[model samples]
Target: MAIGKLFIGRKVRDIRQANGATQAQFADMVGISTSYLNQIENNQRPVSASVLLSLAEKFGIDITELSSGQNDRLLSALTEALSDPLFETYSPSLQELKLVTQNAPGFAHALIAAHQAYRRGNEQLASLDDRLGAAPSQEVTPYDEVRDFFHFVDNYIHDLDLAAEQLATELKLGEGENYAALSGHLEAKHGVRVVRGEAGDEAIRRFDPVGRILTVSRYASAPTRDFQIAIQIAQLAAATKIDQVLKQANFRSEEAVEICRMGLYNYFAGALILPYRSFLTAARDLRHDIELLAARFEASLEQVCHRLSTLQRPGLKGVPIFFARIDRAGNITKRHSAARLQFARFGAACPLWNAHQAFETPGRIIRQTAETPDGVRYLCIATQVSKGSAGFRAANPRYALALGCEISYAGAFVYADDLDLSNRGAFDPIGISCRICERIKCTSRAVPPLKRKLVVDHRVRNPMPYEID
Candidate 1:
C-alpha cells in the first residue's frame, strides 16, 4: 500500500499566522530554513516528519491538527455539489478535486457557495408558476433555513458544546447521575419543580414558565426523561448563551432564530448527557459500540448515535460519522453527516439502505457494507428505537436510527468486525435518492434520474417500467 503524502503546508502557515509569528520565525522554530518553509507553505513541498515533531514539541500542538482530513470533507462537498444536474457533463475527477481542495481551499468553498445560491434560485424559480398572477412573495420556510445552517456547520456548535460541558461540571454530574444532577440543578438554581406525571398521549414534556414547573411524561424512558430535563435547564439557564450563538448565526427571520434556539438547547442537552472528552475517549476504547456506550452513559441508542456525528471539535475530533432517523414510511425525521454521505433534503431515502429494513427487525442491529453512487464505502449499522407507549392498546413511537462511518475507519467499529472489507462484491450499492441517483438498472428505483432520458418499450419490460439512458 502506498502511503499518501501529508501536504499540510497550508495548515502550518495557518497555525503560524494565528500565533502572529512570521514565516522566518516559525521556520526557525521548526528547525527548517525560511526558503524551505516558504515552499512548504505554498504547496511546493510536503511537510516533513522532523518539522511535524519539532512543531509539536515546541508549540504543544497535536500532530493530528496539522494533518486533519479537512481536504477529504472539502472534496466530498465539491463532488456532491457538482453532481447536481446543472453540471452533469462538467464533473471533475477525484484527483482534480483533491488538488483543488488541497491547494486552493478558498476557491473550493467559493464554488460550493455559488452552487448553494444556484440551488436556492432554482427552487424559487420552480415555484414561480404557482404565483403567476399574485404579488411577489418571500415566504421561505425558516425551519428549512435553520436546517441548512446546521447542515452546513456539520451539526456541531463548539460554543454551545463547551458551555454545556461547563454546566455539567458545575452540576457535578458523574457517570449514571445525569438525571439526578440535572433535576436537582433545575430545582435549586431556578426554583423550579420537576415532576413526572401522565402527560397527555402526545405530550412528552410540558413546562409552565410562570408556575416554574417542569412536567415529564411517565411513559418516557429514563434517558428521555433526563434529556427533557436537560433541555429545560438549557432554556432556563443557558438562554442568553443560546441567544448569543443564534445572533452569531444571523438568521433571516425570528422564526429561524426560535428554531435555532431549540436546536441549541437540544445540542446542550446532548452535550450534557455525553460530555465531549469523556464520551470520545469511551467511544474509542469500546470500538464505537452504540449499545455499550448508551449503557455506560445512561443515554438512549439514538442519543449516542446523534452525539457521534457531532464530535468534530477541532483538535479533539473523533471519527466522522453520519446519523439518521427514519420512520416506517421511510421518511427521514432527522439526519446529519460529518462524513461524505449526505441525505436528501426532501423525499424518502433510497429503499435499498438497511435503515428502512430496521423497522422489520426491531431491536436487532443490522450491519451493512454499503457503497454510495459517489464510490465511497461505509460501514452502516441500523436498528429501531421506540419511546412513549400509552398503554396496551396504544403503539409506541418508533424510528429507525442509522449510524455509519467511511470504510477507512471501519476497523475501529465493532459492527464491521466480521465483514469482508477487501471483497468488492460484499458491498451493497446505494444512492441518496431515486430522482438524483444515476444507477440505470436499479430494480428498486422509483423514478428515473432527473436529467437522463428514458427508453420505454411495451415488449421489453424488465423490473423497472422504463430504462434510463
Candidate 2:
C-alpha cells in the first residue's frame, strides 16, 4: 500500500501562531527554509517526515494531532447538511470540504449548527400543524432539546466518559466482572441498599434517595439489574461531576437541564460498565460480536451495541457504527450514528431496512448488505429483544435493535463471514426516509418525495400513484 502525503498546513500555522512565533522563526526551529515552510503552511506541499520529527522533538507536539483533528466529524456533518434539498443544485467536492474544515473549522461548525437549528425549527412547525386545534407555543419539547444536544456532540461526552472510567478503576472492577461486585461496591461505598423487588407496573428501577434504597424490578434480567444499579450509582455518586458537565451546556429550560442530567448519568452508567480500553480491546478480539461482548462485559445486547457507537476516544478509536432501536410500529425509540448514516428526525426509517423485518423473527439475528440512496454500503444486523414481564397479565416491552457499519469495516465483523462483498446485486437499496429518498422507482415508497414533483397520469399504471420527477 502506498503511504498518503500528510498535509498539516493549517495545523502548523495554528501551532506557530499559538506559540507567538513568526513564520521565519518557526521555520528556523524546524530546520526548514522560510519559503519551504510557507509552502507547507499554505498546503502547496506536504509536511516532510523530518519536519514531523522536528515538531515532536522541538515543540513537543503530537504528530497524530496535526493530521486527525475534527476533520472527519466536520466532513460527516457537512455532507449531511448539504444533502438537504436547498443545496441540491450545489455540492462541494470532498477536497473543498477538507480545505474548509482545515482552514475555517469554526465557520464550518457554525454552518452545521445553523442548519440543524433550521431543521429543528421546521420540524417544530410541522408538528404544530399536525395538532389541528392545539395552540402553538414557542417552547420546544425538552426531550427534543436534549436529543439535539446529544446529536451535535455525536453521542459521546469525553469528560463524562473519562470520569466514569476513573470511577470504574476505583471500584476495583475487572474485565468480565458480574453485577455482584458492582452491587457490593454501592452498598459498601455509598451506604446504599441494593434490593430486587417489584418496582410497580411501569417502573423498572426506583431509587429512594432519602432512604438510600435502590429497588430494581424482580422481572429485570441480571444485566438489566446491573445497569439499573449503575445508573443509580451515577445519580448518587457522580451527581457533582454530571452537574458540572451540564452547567457548561447552557440549556434553555430547567426541564431540558434535568433531562440532560439523566442522559449524562445514563452515559456514565454505560461507560462505567464498559470501560473504554478494556471494552475496545475485547471488541477487537471478538470481532465485535455483540453476544460475546455482552457476556464479557456482563451487559445486555442493546447495551453492548450502544457502547459500540460511543467508541469515539480520540487516539484509540473503534470501528464507527450506527445503533438504533425501533418498536414494532416502526417508531425509532433510540438512535445514534458514528458513521455517515443519519437517521430520519421526524419519521420512521426506510421500510426496506432490515430493522423493520427483525420483528418478524424474534431472537434471531438478521444480517443484510444494504446500500443507502447515497451509494454508501453497510453491513446491517438486527435482532428483536423482548423485556419480560413480572406476571402473565403485564405487558412486555419489545423492540428491534439495529447496528451497522460501513462496508469497509465489514471484514472486522463476525456476522460478515461467508457473505459476498463484491456482488453488488446482494446489496438491498435503502434510504434515510421516504420523504427525502430520491429513488423514483422504489415500489416500497409510501409517499412521494417532498422535493420532487409528482406527474399524475390516469392512463399510465405504475406501482405508485404518480411518477416522481
Candidate 3:
C-alpha cells in the first residue's frame, strides 16, 4: 500500500499451489476474482495491503511477506505469532522490532516464532478443560505448575538458606552491612568472580560456567549484581536436585520440564540472594521501605520485590503478596504469588495500579490501594528497574515490578503506612477479573472480565452499573 511496495504475488501463488489450491480455488476461498488473483501473482497489478491481508487470512499466511516482498516462511510465521495476545504486551516495541528487522532480522524472526510456539502450547493446554470435560488425567494448570515449583524450593531450603546464614556469620555482617559482605564473601569463598561489563545485546547477565565468572552489566547496582551471582550459583548447585524434582513431575516433554527446572533454579537464586528470614526482618524493621531495603541489601528495587513474594514458608509465611513484573507498555513478564489475584493469561494488565505509574518515576517507588469488584482490596507498591544488555539510551528497556497484599495485612509491613488508607482517595479501587469488572465507573478497563456478567438494576444507576447479582 505504501509507495514502491514490493509485490510478493508470485510467492503467494507458489505457496498456494504448494498447498494444492489453484488460482480459481484460492480466489474463491479469499472472496476475490481469479483474474485479480492472476494479476497479483504475475506482479502485473499491485496487491493492495487490504488484498494481501485477505489473501493471508485465506492462505493462513502472514501479511509481512507480501509487504516486505520476502518468501521467508519462518519470518511470516513469526510475524503472525507475535500478534498473539500472550506476546502483544511483552514483545519488543515497534521501534525495537524495526531495529531487529534492520540489524538482526534472523534473531527477530526466531524470537517471534519461539514466542508464538510458546503461547500456542499454553493456549492449547488452557482449552483442555472444556475439550476434555473434567477428565481425571489433566493435573497441571499454570497454577499447579507454580505451586509445585515453590514446593520444590520449600523442600530444598538447605543450600540457599544455609549459605546466606553461613555467609552472614562468617563475614560478620552484623546488623546493616551483610549484603556487601555477602557479595565479597561469595567472590572470595566460592571463586565466583563478578565483573562489570556492558549489558550485552541479548541478556542482562551471562554466567560463564566454564570460566566460573559472572559478567554483569555496569548498569546493575551492587546488590543486583550480587543477586545475579547468587542466582547463578544456586542454579548450578541445585541443578541436580531441580532435575530430580522435574523428572518426578513426569511432564509431557523434556523441553517443558527443562524450562520449568531452569525457572525454579532462578527462583531459588533470588531466594538465596535475599534470604527470606533476614529480609523479612529487615522489611518489618524498615516498614517495607523499598529504597531502604534496596540500600541495605545492595539489590535493585525489582530484586527486592521479587524476593518479597517468595516469603511463603508454609506455617511461618510472611504476608501473602501477589507479585507482577511488567514492561513500559503494561506487558507482564513475571507473575507469582500466594495472594488471591487474577491476571489475564494472554493480555495486558489493569492500567490503574502503581506498577504503571512507577514507569514514569523510573527508580522511585509508587504506592496505591485498590479494591477489586469482588470486594478484595490490596496495597500495591512498585518501581521500575532496568533490563537488557543495553544502556539508558533508547535501547535500554525498563521494566516494573509490583508487589501487593490484601488490606488486612497492611499493618504487617511498612509499605504505605503514611497514606490515609481508610479514605476513598487513599484507595484506588481495581479488579482482578478484567472482563467481568462491573465498575462502569472505571475508565481504564479494556474489556469487562467475563465473570462480571452484567445484571440489570432498574431502580438505581450506581457508579458500578453491574447487575444486582
Candidate 4:
C-alpha cells in the first residue's frame, strides 16, 4: 500500500510558535533548512519521516498525535458533507479532498460550515409558511461548536483526566466508598451539602449556589447520585484546570464555552469515579467484561461502556472502541469512537445494526460481527438500559448502549469469545445510513443512495428495488 503524504503545515507552525522560536532557529532544531521549513509551514511540502523523528527527539512532540486526531476526523466529515445530494454537479477527487483537509483546513472548515448552514436553512424554510414567519439565515449552534471540540479531540481530555485520576487516589474512591468520599469532600472543602430532594421532585440535581446545597432526586439510583456528587466536586475543585482547557478551546459563543465547560466537568466526574490507571487495569484483567467491570466499580452499565471508549491516554492506550447510546426511535444521543468506524451524523443509524434490535431483548446483550461498506469488520454488542422515574407519571427514559472495536481486538473482549469470528458469513453487513450507503441490494434500504443511478422494474410485481447503481 502506498503511504499518503502527511501535510501538517498548520500543526508544524503551531509547534514552532508555541515554543517562541524564530523560523531559522526552529528550522535548525528540527534539522531542516530555513527555506524547507518555510515550505512545510506554508503547506507547500509534506513533512518527511526524518523531520517527524526530529520533532520527537528535539521538542518531545508525539508524532502519533499529529498523525491522527483533527486531520483524520476532519477529512472524514468533509467527505461526508460533500456526499450530500445538493452537491450533484461537483465531484471532487479523494486526493483533492485530502489536499484541502491537510493544507488549508480553515477553507475546508468554512466549506463545511456553509454546507451546515445550507442544511439548517432548508429545515427553517420548510417550517416558515406554517409558522407565519420568514426564513432567516441560521448561525451554527453552540451545541455543534462544543460537539466539534470534543470530536476533534477524540473524546480525551488529557490534563483533566490526569487531574481527576490524582484526586481519586487522594479521596480513596478505589476503596468502593465513592459516594461518601465525594459528598464529604464537597462539604468539607467547598461548603457544599448533598441532600436528597422531595419525593415528587422530578429534577435530578438542583443546586442553590448561594446556599451551597446540591439537592438530588430521591428516586435517582445510587450510581446517578454518586455521579451528580462527582459533577459538583468537579466544578468546585477543578475550576482552574477546566478554565485552562476552556481558554485553549476559544469557543466563539459564551453558550458554547459553558456547554464545553460542563462537558469537561462531566469528563472529570467520570475520570474520578473510574480512575484511568486502575480502571484500565481492571478492564484488561477481566477481559473487557462490561457487567463485571460495572460490578467491580459500582457503576451502571452505560457508565462502564462510555468509560471504555475514553481510554486513549497516549502510549498506554486501551482497545480502540466505539460507544453510542440510542433511543427507541434510533436517535443516537451520545456517541464517541476511537475506532475507524464513524457513526452517521445526520439521521438515524443503519437499521440493520443490532442496536435497534436490542429493545426486543431489553436486558440481554446481543453480539455480532458486523462489516461496514468500507470492509472494516467490528465485533459489536448492544443492550437496553432504562432510568428509574420519580413516579408512574414521571418520564423514565430508556436507551440502548452499543459498544464495539475492530475485529482484530476481539481476543481482548469476553463478549466475542462465543462468536465465529473466522467465518466470513458470520459478519452481518451494515452501513452508516441508507442515503449514503453504496450497497447494491438491501431490503432495509429506505431510499436509494443520493449519488447512485437506479433502474426500476415494475414487471417483477414486487416491493423490492430492482437495481441500485
Candidate 5:
C-alpha cells in the first residue's frame, strides 16, 4: 500500500500560482531541479528535506507544517468558484460540492481566491457608488454581522450569573467532588455514559439524540469535562433563545444559520460555566490572574480567557478585547474578540505579535502593549494551553490561545499593575487592521491586504503601488 504523503501538493501548487511564480522559478529559488519540483507538485515524489527546509526558510514557516495536514482545511478553489448563492437556490448538489471543498483542500483554495476576488470586485463597485451618488447597498457583509454580534454582546448583560449560581447550588457542583459524581448525575438524569476512553478516540463526546444519552471521554481535564456539561446544559436550557437569535439574523443559508446557532449555544455554555458578574469580580479581584480565575471558576485557563472576551454583554461591559488562537506556524484556529483588530481573513496572521511567545511559557499569563498604525494602543495577554485526545488511543496534540484588549482598560484588572506602562519598555508596536493599513514599510507582512490592487508598471517610480488597481 502506498503511504499517504502528508505534504499538501495541491496547496503548494496553488500557492505557487498565486505568487505568479513559474515552477522553474520556485525550483530555482529552493535550489532544486525543476523536474524534481514538478514530480513533488504532481504527488509522484515526496518533498525532500532540503526543498522543504528551503521553502520554510523563505516563507518563515515551520518545516512541520510543510509536512502535515490541517485539522480544519477550508474548501477548494474550484468549489468556491462554483458555489454561488444562486446554485444553493436551484441545486442541492451544490451543497455537497461545498462540503467536498471544505473537506478536500484542492477545492479550498479555488473557493477562497474566488470569494476574495468577488469581494474585491464588489468593494470596487461600492467605491464607484460614491461618485454616482447612489444609495449604499443593503447587503450585510459577514464582517458587519460579526461586528454587530460583538457590539450587542458588549452591552447586553444577561442573568446567566444567577442561573449558574442556582444550578451549581441545586446540583451541588461546587467544592467539587470527583468527576465521577457528575458523570453519575448525568447518567441518572440524561442517560449519558461517562466512560473513560483513550485520548484521540476520534469522537471525544458523542450525543445520541435518539438515545438521549452522551458518551463523554475520560481523558478530559476537570475543566474540559465541566465545559462539556455546560454545553449540554446550554443546548437544553437555551435552545429557544438560541433559535430565536439565529432566526432573527436572516442568514443567507441554512448551514450558515446552523453554524451561528451552534456558536451562540457555545457562547451560552461559556456564560453558564463562568457567570459574568462573579467571573468579572474574580478577574478584577485577582488582578486578571488566569490561574486564580481558573481555580475559582473550575475552568481551564483558555476557557476563562475566551469568556473574558464575551464580557461585552451590552450595558454592563467588561473590557473590549481581541482574541486569537494560533499554532506555531501562525495558523489561527479559534478567534473571537470585540476589539478592532486587523487580521488576514483567509491566510496566516501577523508574525510580530507576542501571542506566539506564550507557547514558550505555558500557563503563565504574558502581557504586552501594542500600538496600531492608527496610534491606538492595546494590552495583549496571551498563554498556551494543552491540547490532546481524551481517550487512551487518542493522539491528542497541544495548542495555544492568545488574547488581548486595549491598554486603556488594563487598569480595570490587576494582571499588570506593577508593570510600568510609562516605561514603554515591555510594549511592542503592532497593527489591528492589516488590510486597510497603509504601512507598506512593515517587513513582517505575510501577504498584502485584499484591498490593495496590484499594478504592473514598466515605468513606475516605485515597485509597489498603494492606490487601487
Candidate 6:
C-alpha cells in the first residue's frame, strides 16, 4: 500500500490545545524543536515518522489516527461540493483547496454541509418555478443523518463488534443453530418467547414487551428468521452496550437516535451471526466468494457483502470493499464503503456501472472493471436479488447488489480472476453522478457537467448534441 503525506495540522493543534499545552511544551513533549512544531502546526511541513510515532505513543492515541484517510475524505467531499453550479464563479485552485482542507478543515466541512443543504432544497423545489431564488432549509433528514454517521465511520464499530463476538462465543451459538441458540438465550436471559406468526402477515417481525412475545413471520426464509432472532438478541441482551454506543453517538434528534439504535442493533446481529474471526478466515480461504461464504455462514448474500465492508478491525483488517444495493430505478437504497470509492449521496448512480446491468440478467453475477473520473479502477461484481412476497398477487421487492474493491486489491477476489486488470483499455469509464461528472463525450450522460461550458457546433455533427468545454 502507498502511504500518502500526512497533513493533519489542525487535528494536531486541536489536540495540543485541548490538553492545555503551549507550543514550547508540546514541542518538548514530542521531542521536536519549537520552530519545527510551529511549521508542522501551520501545514508548512508534513509530520515526520518520528514525530508521528512520538505523538501516538506520548499521547496514547492509535497510530492510524494520524493517517491521511480523513484528510482525503474531507478533500474529496469539499471538491465535489464545490462543483455545484451554485459555486460556479468561486472556482478555487487545487492548491487553495489543499490549503483550506489542511488548515481550515472545519470551515471547509461547514461550507460543504451548507452546499448540501442548498442542493437538497433545490432538488425538493425542482418542479416549482423561481426555486433558484428561494433559500434552502437548513435541515437534514434523520435517515440521511444516521446513514452518514455509519458511512463516515467506514461501517465498522470495533467495540460493538467485539461485544457481539464475545456474546456469540459465550452463548455457544454455533453455525446452523443460530436461531435456536438465540431463541433459547432470549427465553433464559430475558423471559421472552419466540413464535412464528401466520404467513399472511406483512410484517417481518413484531415484538410485544408486555406479553414477552417476539413474533416472526412464517414467510421469512431460514436465514432471515435467524437474522431476526439475532436482532432481538441485540435489543434485549445487548441493551446496555447499545445504550453506551447511542450515548457516544449523541444524535441531534430523537428520531435519528432511534434510527441509529436500529442500525447498531442490525450491525450487532450481523457480527453475532458471522463472528469476526471465523468469517474473516472463511472469506480469505474462499477468496471472498460471496456465495460460498454465504453458504458457509448461512447468511444472505446481502448480509455477506455488507459484512465484508465492515472488516476494518485495525490490525486484523480485511480487504477494503465497497458494497451498495440499487433498485431497478438506479436509486441506491443501501451503501457503505471501506474503499476510496464513495457513492453519490444524492440522485441515481452512473448508468455505465455494471451494477445496473445486474437487473437485466437476474441471478447471475455481472462483472466489470470500471475506471472512475478520478482514475481509480475497481473490480466490480454485481447480482440481482429478490424476495418472494409469499403470495402470487403481491409485489416482490428486488434490488441489484454491487460489491467491489480497488484494482490493486482485486487479486483477493474470486470475481476478478478471469479479468484482464492490467490492460487499462479493458476498463469501462464511469462516474459518480452526471451532474458533477467530468466525463466528456459520454453517450449515457443525462445532463452536462455543472461547472463546465458547452459548445454547440451544428456544422460539425457528433454523437453528442453539444461538445463539452
Candidate with the larger lDDT of 1 and 4: 4
Model 2: CA > 4 A from native: 1-135, 138-140, 172-177, 198-202
Native-referenced Cα lDDT, model 6: 0.85
Worst 10 residues of 4 by lDDT: 1-10
Measured over all alpha carbons after superposition, the RMSD of each candidate to the real structure, in angstroms, is 3.7, 4.0, 22.3, 3.3, 23.4, 3.2
TM-score winner among the candidates? 6
The top-ranked prediction according to lDDT is: 4
Tens-place lDDT per residue, model 1, 75-128, is 666766776788878867766676688778879877876776677667677888
* Every model's TM-score: 0.84, 0.83, 0.58, 0.88, 0.60, 0.89
- Candidate 4, residue 334: Cα displacement in angstroms equals 0.6
lDDT of 4 at 399: 96
> How do the residues 330-398 of candidate 4 rate in per-residue lDDT, one tens digit apiece?
889898888878876677799999999899998899997999987889999999999886777777789
Estimate, for each residue in 1-469, the C-alpha lDDT of model 2 and write its tens digit. Answer: 1124776689999889988999999999889999999998888888888898899898878665565435655666676677677776887887778778777877886777667777766766788767767755545568877986787676888988888888888775555465777888888988899887755646688888789898888888888888899998888778888888788888879999999998998999999989888889999999999999988887899999999998878666788789999999999988888777888765568999999889899989999999988788999999999877577877788999999998989999999999998999999999988877889999999877766788999998987888887
Cα shift from native, residue 135, model 5 (Å): 30
The residue-by-residue lDDT of candidate 5 on 1-469, one tens digit each, is 1123334455567667877899999878778888987877766666666666677777555554343213122322233234344234443354454345434644554445456657655666769845575544544455544433433343132544445545555555535652554565567766765555555455556677777766666666778776776677667666776777666666665656666666666676677667676677777788777778888877887788788776654335566566667877767776665654534454465567778788889767777777766566777777777675445655555566777766766786565577676766566766543443446666665556543455556666554443234
Q: Where does model 5 exceed 4 Å of error?
A: 1-117, 120-169, 172-175, 178-193, 197-201, 209-212, 340-346, 362-364, 389-394, 424-426, 448-469
Candidate 1: stretches off by over 4 Å = 1-12, 27-75, 93-140, 170-177, 198-202, 392-395, 435-438, 450-459, 462-469
Indicate the residue-level lDDT of 225 in model 6. Answer: 90
TM-score of candidate 6 relative to the true fold: 0.89
